[model samples]
Structure formats: structure tokens, C-alpha cells
Target: MSTAVKHDDFQLPVMSGYAKESYDLCKAHKLSFQRCAKCKTFRQPPRPLCNKCHSFETEWAPVKGTGKLYAWTIPMNPIGKAWVSYMPYVAAIVELDEGPRMATWVTDVPHDQLKLNMPVKVWYDDLTSEVTVAKFKPA
Candidate 1:
């Protein structure tokens, strides 16, 4: 089962193996994704094999960390007490320059200023000593 850690009342993903590697790289402020070494396909939410070529040959590849805001939504209601503090947060889907879409929170921009296809870049937030969540903001 996937593990989660509680931080400021929020349950965050636990770092292990691929996830660990991703977070470790994020701690160093690097953005990356798993790339199929055989077919040169970049994938997120890292897996052991390529979905397209069905090959186990893969490697963590760094990305340019630039993307366009594909979509977004503001939660009108909090899911739980843990989310109360972030009630007005914006959840967004960013279509990366490499063509992968990442689900992340867009910050540093007002909700009224958000626009479709706006240029954005990845930013890391160290939620804990061992975990850093990727966020996005206007570029």
C-alpha cells in the first residue's frame, strides 16, 4: 500500500524508491520524470516499465520545468479540517514543454489572473525535512 505522512493536518505522499528519488531531486530544486530508455518516452508518477513499449529499461530524466497552465479549479469547500487553511487554493493541470501533464497547485498568482495556456514553471515546496511537493507559478 502507498504510504502517506501527515503534515500541518494534510496527508502527504511518502518518499520511497522512485518517489524518494523524485523528492530528493526536488530537495535539490531539480525537476525530472521517468524516461523509457528504449523508446525515449518521458512519464510521470514513475513506474517500473514503459506503458507504450512495455520495457523495463527506464531512467530518471531532468525536464526543463516549463509548461503552460492547461486547466484549473478552486475548491469552494474544504474536504476536511486539514484543508480548511487552504480552502481557496487552486488545483491545476500543467502541460509540460515535453508533453506530460502534471497535477499540481498553482501559487504566486491570484485566482482572477489565472488564464488558460498561460506560461508557468515548476517550483518546489519543502513541506517537511524529507518531503518536497512540486508547485507551479506564473513564469
Candidate 2:
């Protein structure tokens, strides 16, 4: 994976334990999420336990990187100065083929053209040398 192409002064996502792991995998161009080792359930916003089976054991599982656009929104104002250039970006909820819904951004399509249940695939945007964020694009 390559570092994200820098545009302006956009701030990168903060890295924590599981989030660091996720970002590291994305740096390698892999799209992974936390999965319960016992019951095999996938989850995002990676946590310490499985919500479904209440299991403590978990693993980082790579996903197919394909999914459907469940929903989306285009905020009228940018959050801050760094995001000013990219105002009105499409933020979306994508339901992965494996059943987990992730919060991501929809790219490569105009906001007006976005549709519910539209096919999409995971794409990486390297925000810095050490961070890569996962986004979705029309498949």
C-alpha cells in the first residue's frame, strides 16, 4: 500500500490499539475487521468482546472488500479548515458482504447519483505515512 496522496492540511485519524492494528493492515492494503474467534461474527469499531456470543477471544479478519451502500449523507459544511476543500463529501454506511456495516465515505460517484443498495467496494486513502483510512466506491 502507498501513502495517501496529500491534498492540503487534512488531519489524519487518531490511532489507538485496535485502530492502530486496523490502520497497519490498511497500510498493507488489506481491509480487515474484528471477528469473534468462537462464533465467527465480524464487527467494526473493534472492541474487546463479541457482542453476539459474548466471547472474549477475537481475531482480525480480512473482508472481501465488497458491499452494498446502505445509506449516506452529504454534510453541507466542512468540519474544519483542513476539510474545507472537500466540502459536501458523501459519508455512508456500507453493509459488507460478510454482514457488518461500516461507516465510510463513498467515492468515485456524484452525491446525486448515489442510490440505496448500490454495489460498492473498499478502497484505501492513505492520510499519512502511518495511516490509511478505508472508503467505498462504486463497484
Candidate 3:
């Protein structure tokens, strides 16, 4: 298998193996999906057990980044010291087209502009050579 060569602009992912697929999807600019074996349901936030049937069989699937805003919140303050720089960022609950909900960062736009029921798509931020975090924002 080939690996991404590092250069002046090369970025790494945050994890490997399990989350590797999500990182790869981000690098490929697609949203990775997780599927439940028992329910045949697609999901995010990769799981080791099927939420629907409590089965241990689960699979990662790819998904289109488009979704509707299921819920949201404007944090009163950033918790960690590093996050202080981007205080008041919107933490959102998105209902994906596949019928699963995802908690991802909303970015690429000002926080004030976010509203319930807004359209959004997947966005990626490369955090390391083996990790890339997924976020969402107005589409």
C-alpha cells in the first residue's frame, strides 16, 4: 500500500486503524460512514457494537457530506485553553441523509449566521500524518 508523502503542505491524521477510514475519507474529500450489521443502518461516531441490536458486527461505510441541521448550540465559553482562540464556536447536531445524527464542528463561516434547519456538508482538517478530523458547515 502507498502512503502520503510529507512535503511542505502534507498533513497527517489524528488516528490510525479504526478511525483511519474517516481520515482517508477526509483526505479524499468524502464523508465516511459506519453501518450497523443487525439493523443495516448507517452511522457516524464509529461504534464497536450495533446500537440497534447490540450486536458486535459493525462496518464503516462512506457517506455524502450533505445533511440538515437537527440541532445546535452556541457555547458560552471555550473549555480548553487552546480552544479559547475560537470561543463561541457553534457545536451542532446534524441529521444526516442516512437517518443518523452526527456531532461535528460547524466552520468556514461566522457563528452568528448559523440557524436551525440549515444545509451543511462535510469538511476536513488534517491534524497529523495519520489523523484528520471531520467537521461540517453551511453548504
Ranking by TM-score: 2, 1, 3
Better of 1 and 2 by TM-score: 2
Give the per-residue lDDT digits (tens) of candidate 1, residues 1-84. 111223555776676788888788877888778889999887677888898999999887888999999999988697778776
Please give the RMSD of candidate 2 to the true structure.
3.2
| Model 3: CA > 4 A from native | 1-28, 51-55
- lDDT string for model 2 (53-129, tens) is 99989898988999999988887687777665666678789999988888888888877789999999988987777
Q: Estimate each model's TM-score.
A: 0.87, 0.89, 0.70
In candidate 1, stretches whose alpha carbon ends up further than 4 angstroms from where it belongs are 1-7
Highest-lDDT candidate: 2
Q: On TM-score, who's better, 1 or 3?
A: 1
Best-performing candidate as measured by TM-score:
2
> Which of candidates 1 and 2 reaches a greater lDDT?
2
> What is the lDDT of every predicted structure here?
0.80, 0.82, 0.67
**What ranking emerges by lDDT with the best candidate at the front?**
2, 1, 3
Which pairs clash in model 2? 4-126
